[model samples]
Target: MKEFASIDIGTSYTRVLMGRMGDDGVIQINGAGVSPSQGVRNGGVVNIEQTVQSIQTAAREAELMSGLVVEEAVVNITGKHLKGENSRGVVAVTNRDRVVTESDVLRVIEGAQNIRIPADQEILHVLSREFVVDDQSGIRDPIGMTGVRLESEVHIVTAGKTALTNLRKAVNAAGIRVTNLVMSSLASSEAVLTSGEKDLGVAVVDIGSGVTDIIVYVDGGVFSSATLPWGGSHVTQDLSFGLKIPMEAAELVKRNSGCVQIAAVDPIEKIELPAMSGRPPRWVLRQEIAAIMEPRMREIFELVDQELMRSGKKNALSGGVVITGGGSRVEGAASLAEEVFSMAVRKGNPLPLGGFFDRVDGPEFATSVGLLIGAAQSTDTARKAPRESGSGWMQKLRSWVSENL
Candidate 1:
C-alpha cells in the first residue's frame, strides 16, 4: 500500500484528505479535515502567516484522525492568473521502417512547446489533446503505425511566477513539502467525471467561494480551461447588500435557504432573518431570498457559457455540463445552469470511496479527493518503467517542468 495526502486551499476553506491505495486497487480514505480559510482570496495566498496557520490547522486535524504524519501533499492551485492556449507540432518519422515511434512523438511535443511564453509566467501543464499520424487525424495512439510524419495538438496551462512562488512558500511554512500542484478544475474532474463523459465531450465547472473554474474535454482529453474571478462569495455579498443583513448572516441564510430558481421554492415557506444591529428579526418568504440569488447565479452560468463559446467547444459538448464544488450544493443550481446553457446539467459529487470517507462524498470534497487519486496514480506511474513517448512522455515532460522550470 502507498499512502497519499491531498490539500485543497480555497478562498473560504482549506481541506485535507489522507488515504492509501491498497494492493486490491481500492483507495481507502483514512482521514479528512476542513478549516475556515484566512489570508486567501480568489485561490491565491495574500498573507503567508495566516495561510500557513490555516494549512496547519487543517493538516493537523487530518493527521490526528488518520494517525499518520504527513510529510508531503499534492496541493491544488487556482486563480485569475491562470491562462491556457492550444498549439500544434509536427515531426518526421525517424524509424528505419518509417513507423511512428515514441521518439517521434516526444520530438513533436517538444516542438509544440517552442511557442512563446510570457516572461512573468511559467507553464504548469502540457496536456495532449490529440495525435495525428500522417494525414490520419484523431489517432489516440500512433506508435508502431506506418507513417512518415507524426503530429500532436496540445493545450498548455500557465500560471504567474509570483503566484506559484507565494503558494509554495505558504505550503512550506505549514510544515509540509508540496509534492505537486494540480489545477483545481483538473482535480475536480478526476473525482466527478467518467470516461464516457469525456469521450463524448463535457464541461466541468467548479464554483468555489471566490473563483469559478472551467475545464472542457473532447474525445477524452482536455480542450480548454479557464478561471473566473467571482463565485459563491459574490452571491453572499449580493444577498448582504440586498437584504440589509450582515455578511455572516447572509452567508448562513444562503447556505440554509438559498435557491437559484424561484420556481423550485414553495410560495408560502418562510425563513427567519437574523436581527441586525438596529433592527428586529423578520420572517421573509423563501422566494424572496431566491430572488436575490437567481440573478447572480444566472450571470455566473452565462459567463461560463461565454467561456465555452470562446473555446469553440460549445456546440461540441454532447455530454453537457457538470457543476461541482461548494457552490453546486445551492438549491436549484442545476436548473439555473440548464436554463443558462440551454443544455443538460447535473450536480457533481466525489466518486464513492472506502474506509472513513462517508463525510467527504459531497461536491465540496471533489477537489481534495481527486487530488488524492491523482497523487496515487502519479506515484504508480513513477514506479513503472518510463514510456518512450505520447501522453506518457507528455506527463514526464510536465513533471520535469513542474520541478525545474
Candidate 2:
C-alpha cells in the first residue's frame, strides 16, 4: 500500500492525516494528528517560526504513528487575499465547418486564461462553469460536435504571492514538499459535497477560529468565495469581554454553552462560570449567552448572504448551504443558517474515505481529508501524458516530466 499525507494549516489548529491507497481505489486513513496552530490569524501565516513548529509537530506525530516517511504533502490555504471572479473566452474552431475536436476545447480554455491578475498574485484555479457551443448554450462537452465557435465560462481563483511563499516556506521547513495548494473552502467542499449538490447549486461555509470562509457553487462551479475575519475567536472574545473572564475560560464556556438560535436555549437554563483572578464566580443564563452569539452569528450569515446576492447566486442555490469546520460544530448553527438564508441548511461532516477516519470524522477534518483526495487526483494527473505537450504519447510524457514532474 502506498501512503500519502495531507496537512491543513488552519487559523486555530493544524491537522495532518496519513492515508494509504488500497487496490480498490479507496483511500484509507492510517494515522491522524493535530496541534494548536500559532502564527496564523484570519487564514494568513503571521509568524513563520510558529507556523513551522505546528506543521512539524503534526507531521512528525502522524509519521510516528503511521511509520510512513512523509515527503510530499498537500497544503490547504485560505485568506481574505484569495479572490475569485467570473470570465468568458471564445475560440473559433480550426475547421469552422468540421466537428469540434479536443484541441478546440483546449483552445477555448486557453482563451479563458486571459485575466488581469496582480503581479503579486498567482492563479490557483480556473474552473469551467459551463460551455457554450456556437449559439447553443449549457453544453457540458463540445467534442465531436460541429460548431463554428466554442466558448467557455470559467471562474478564476487567485491568491497573494507573499502569503503563498510564506506557506510554502513553512512546509519546506518541516522537510516536506508541498505537492499542491488548495483553497480551504474548496478543500472542505471536496470532502463533504456530492456531485449532485454541486450540479444543483450549493454554498459551503467553512468557519475556523479567526475567520469564516464562504463559497457558493452554481452551474457546477464556484460562483463566489470570500472570508469574514470573525469566527469562534470572536465569540470567545465576546464572552471574555462580557463576563470579564480569561480568554481560555471564555473559550471553554463558549464551547460548552454557545447556541446560535435562541430557541435552542432554555430560559431557565443556568451555567456556573469558572472564577477568574480577584473575581467572584458568576452564574449566567443560557439566554444571555445566546444573546452574545446570536448577533455575531447573524452578522456572519448576513455577510454570506450579501456575497451570494452579489455573485447573482442567491436564488440559484437550490441545494442550500453546507456548513463545515470547527466553528460550524456549534449547536444550533444549522437552524441559524436556515433562518438567515431562508433555505435548507445542514452541518457537513468529512467524507467517508474508509478505515479509521470514521472514528475521527467531523467538520474540522474536512480540509485535511480533501487535501488527501486532491493529492491523489494530482498524482494521477502527473502520471499521465498531458495533451498540451505533443501529439505523440511518448513525446508528451517526456515533455510533462521535463516541465512538471
Candidate 3:
C-alpha cells in the first residue's frame, strides 16, 4: 500500500495527516494527528529542537493511528519572507513542424525563471498564468498549436533560503524526510477553491495564528500572493489585555465565544472568565469580546484589501474571497471580510474528497488535506511514463497537477 502523507507546521499547532490514494484518484484519510506547536513563530521555525520535538510527537500519533510510518511527506512553507511576482518568458518553437510541444512548453516555463532575485532567496514555484502563440494571446495550453513563437506568463514564488534551511533542519531532525515544500496558500487553494472560482477570479485568505496568507487567482491562474504579520494571536492579546485575563484563558474565551462583529454576537450573552493571578472570575458580555475582536479582524481584512488593490486585481475578484485557517474559524470572519472588501465572502473548509473526510473537515486542515491530495497524485503520476502522443502538453499538465501543487 502506498502511504501518502502531509505535514502542516502551523504557528499554533502542528498537523500530520496520513492517507492513501485510491485507484479512483481520491484520497482516503487513514489517520490524522495534531499537537501544540513550539519553536515556531508565524509558521517559521525559530528553535529547531522544539520544532523537531513537535513534529515527532504529531508523526507518532498519526503513525500509530494508521499503522503507517511517515518516512517522508509534503510539508508546508510560510512566513513573511515568501513573495510572489508575475513574469513573462518568450521562446521560439524548436519542432520541425513548428507545433508547440511539451518540450517547448517546458523551455518557455524555464525561460520565465530568469528574473532577478535576491541571492538569499530561491524560487519555490513557477505557476503558469497563461500562454501566447504567435500573435494570439490568452492561451491556456499552447501545445499542438502551430506557432513559431511561444510565450509563457507565470507567477513565481520565492522563499528565503535561511527560512527553508531551518525548516528542513527541524523536519529532518524529527526522523523523517521532507518530500516537498509547498506554499501554504497554494496548498489550501488545492482543497478549497473551485475551478469556477479560479476562472472567475477569487482570493483565498488563510488567516493563520501568527500570520495571514493571501493568494489571488484570476483567469484560472495565480496573480499574486502576500503574507501579513498579524493574525488571530493579536485578537487573543487584545482579549487578554482588555479582560485582564491570562493568555491561555483569553484564548479559551476567544474560541468558546468570540465573534468578530458585535452585531453577530448577542449583547445579552455573557462570558465567565476563569480567575487568573488570584483575581476573581468576572462575567462580561459577549459583545464586549466581539467589540475587541472586531477592530483587529477588520484591520486584517482591510490589509488584505490593500494587498488586493496593490496587485491591481482588486476589480477582478468577481468570485470574491474565501477565508480559511485558524483565524478564519473565529465567528463572523467572513461577515467582517465581506464588509471590508465590499465583495461576497465565505468561510472555506476542505471540500468533500473521500473517506474519513469527517476527521479533517474543517478550514484549519485545508493545507494538510491539500498536501495529501497532491502527494497521492504525485505517486500515481510517477508510475506512468510521459506520453509522446500528439496531445502534447496535456500529459505533462497531468503530471504538473501533482508536482506544482
Best by TM-score: 1
Pairs that collide in candidate 3 are none
lDDT of 1 by residue, 1-405 (tens): 668899999999999999887767878888898999999999899999999999999999999999998789999999999998999998999888998876787788778888889999998887888888878999877777998888999998999999999999999989999989999999999999999999999999999999999999999989999999989999999999998888999999999989999999999999999767777779999999999999999999999999999999889999999999999999899988998999999899988878787969899898999999888777766776787445565567567656655
lDDT (Cα, tens digit) per residue for candidate 2, span 1-405: 457788999888999888877777888788788999999988899999999999988888887878887899888989888888888889988975668877776677667878899998887766667778889898766667887889988877888989889999999988899877888888899899998999899999988888887888887777788777878788788878987788899888888887878778899999999767777778999888888888888888888888778888789999999989898887788888899989999999987886677645989898889888877665555555564332233233222322331
Cα lDDT tens digits, model 3, 165-253, are: 99989999998888788899999988998899999999999998998999999999899999888889999999999988889999999
The local lDDT score (0 to 100) that residue 214 gets in candidate 1 is: 97
For candidate 3, give the lDDT of residue 173: 90
Q: Quote each prediction's TM-score.
A: 0.96, 0.92, 0.95
Q: For model 3, state the Cα shift of residue 236 in Å.
A: 0.5
> Model 3 misses residue 110 by how many Å?
1.2
* CA-only RMSD, every prediction: 1.8, 3.7, 2.4
lDDT of model 2 at position 154: 80
Cα-based lDDT at residue 105, candidate 1: 74
Q: For candidate 2, what is the TM-score?
A: 0.92
Q: After best superposition, candidate 3 residue 30: deviation in angstroms? A: 0.5
Cand. 2 Cα-lDDT? 0.82
**How much lDDT does each candidate structure score?**
0.90, 0.82, 0.88
Which prediction has more favorable lDDT, 1 or 3? 1
